[model samples]
Target: MLLIRNLIYWLLVAIVTPLFFLGLFIGAPLPRRTRHVIGESWARLLTWLLWHVVGLRYRVIGAENIVKEPAIICAKHQSGWETLALQEIFPSQVFVAKKELLWIPFFGWGLALTNPITINRSDRANANRLMLEQGTNRKQHGFWISVFPEGTRTRPGVAGKYKLGAARMAKQLDMPLVPVAHNAGEFWPRNAFLKHPGEITLVIGPAIYPRDDVGPEAMTRQAEAWIEARQREIGGVGPFAHPDERKARTA
Candidate 1:
């Protein structure tokens, strides 16, 4: 049954993608509301196809937190499932994804219509610059931007240190920050297409926006501190930094 579902999932991905792109381009000359409806309609279509065709059930939380205000979302990176799942969380979200994703067969090209912030991961310097510039642009456009701070996934029990990309973007833009942690990797291991059934709980914390008197460094430290503490309180597993160090982080 799982194999059959996977087959249908792949087929749906292949079939609906071109129709999505066609709707995007041909529907562009329509009103802004119409275009937004088209884009959202495509999101819903893909979600429906994936759910009915694939046995994978998707669940999202904290939708109420950022529904009104745009933010920089810092989430734990696990399987590519998070990427697709994020669409269901906020169909209006503009992601900071790897530049290579744009080269992917169908979905990548389809994503280009949404103005996602794609970074060149091969070059650290270039990627950071793009992150900062694009972060501000998307924030100004009233769209939430999600960044997987790990840059890549880790095994279930081996999650690594949190990267500073999402924090840097939040601080630079002086926007509200939201941290979401999930245990998706235990079910969807990296580089493996087989997905096991499990509860992928996405926890969204309070939004953190910098104070007028505080600098980016200070604000980032605070954001990190808050999340690290919450993770431990919730009995988070994997590699975690010292709570004190996170709170006192200046660099």
Candidate 2:
């Protein structure tokens, strides 16, 4: 049943994607906000299809933690789920995604229309510079920046090394970082075709302000600590969990 549902959902994605891409050309002559709205509509539609077609639902905790001002979102990257979900959560936002994603066809074109901060991951120095430059510009224009601290998706119960790019941007721009933790990978495994029907919990932790005395490394550590701790509290298995800790948990 789950496999059939997943296939149907993917079929819907294949059918709807090009139609959504047309939004890019249709919205090109309009204002930036208009283009964003068109992009957001596509995201919202996809999210809706995930729930209705795939039977995968989500619940967000601590939504109030989302502040009014633009912020840098430091989130756990587990699967592609959060990418679509975050677009619905934040009003005006841009993701710091890989430049390679822009090469993909209709999807990449749609992403380009949204003006995300794309980086060539092969060049670390250039990528950092571009992140700082473009991230600052996007923030100034009132677009919240969503960055996955791990830089790539991690499997469920696995904790990837958190990078300092988002932290540096937060410190340099004096922006508050909103740490997000979720157990999405448990149901939607990374690059998996089939998704389990379950309620994925997404917890939004309070914004961590970068301290004047603290370096970006310290800030990254602080956010990582909060997110990891919260992930455990929300029943997410951590990669470093003790053998005893894993044994004691209820299934």
Candidate 3:
């Protein structure tokens, strides 16, 4: 049943993705807001399919934590699910993505229209400079910046080394730093073909306002602690399961 569901889901994605890319191209000459709406509409469609076809669902907690102004969002990287899911949850937003993503055929072409702050990840100094500069510009244009501080996705119950880029960008712009945690990897395991049926919980922690006394390192640490602790609370099986419970079950 899982195999059947996954096969059907992928088939739908394959058919629908290119169609949306065409829409993106048609909307390219329009305002950034129109192009963003076109792009995010695609994300909304895919997330809807995940719930209806794949039986994967999600619920957001602490949504009230999201403020009205443009800010920096630091989210845990778990699976591709968050990429699609966050678009629905947040307002007009752009991601801090690697430049290589703009090279992909249809999907990448569509992403390019979204006006993301694309950086060459290999050069840390250059990337940081560009992130702050472009992030500030985007914020001024009323776009919230979403960053995966881990640089890459990690498995469920595993904590990735949080990078300070998001914190630095927030501090540079004096924007609120919002931390997000979720258990999507538990159901949508990274690079896994089969997406299991489950309800993923995404928690948005309170905004950490940049302080003159708080440096990027300290801000990053605070966000990491909150995200990782929330991950443990929401995690179900595998490493997220209580050690004593697993031991007793094995015994």
- Weakest ten-residue segment in model 2 by summed lDDT: 236-245
lDDT against true structure, model 2: 0.84
Error of 1 at 45 (Å): 3.6
Across residues 1-251, which tens digit of lDDT does each residue of candidate 2 receive?
A: 87899999999989887887887878887776778888888788888988998888899999999998899999998888899899998768999989999998877877887889999978987877888889888887889999999989886566799999899999988899999998888777778788777778899989988888999999899999999887776654433233443555644
Give the TM-score comparing model 3 with the true structure, all chains together. 0.93
| Candidate 3, 160-248: lDDT as tens digits | 78988899999999999999999888788779888888788899999999999999999999999999888877776433344543455
Q: How high is the CA lDDT of each candidate model?
A: 0.65, 0.84, 0.89
Candidate 3 deviant stretches above 4 angstroms: 237-251
By lDDT, rank the candidates, best first.
Answer: 3, 2, 1
> Which candidate leads in lDDT?
3
Pairs with backbone N, CA or C atoms under 3 Å apart (clashes), candidate 1: none
> lDDT tens digits, residues 62-120, model 1?
66665467778877776766666666676367778788888987567666667678988
Off by over 4 Å in 1: 27-40, 58-64, 122-129, 212-251
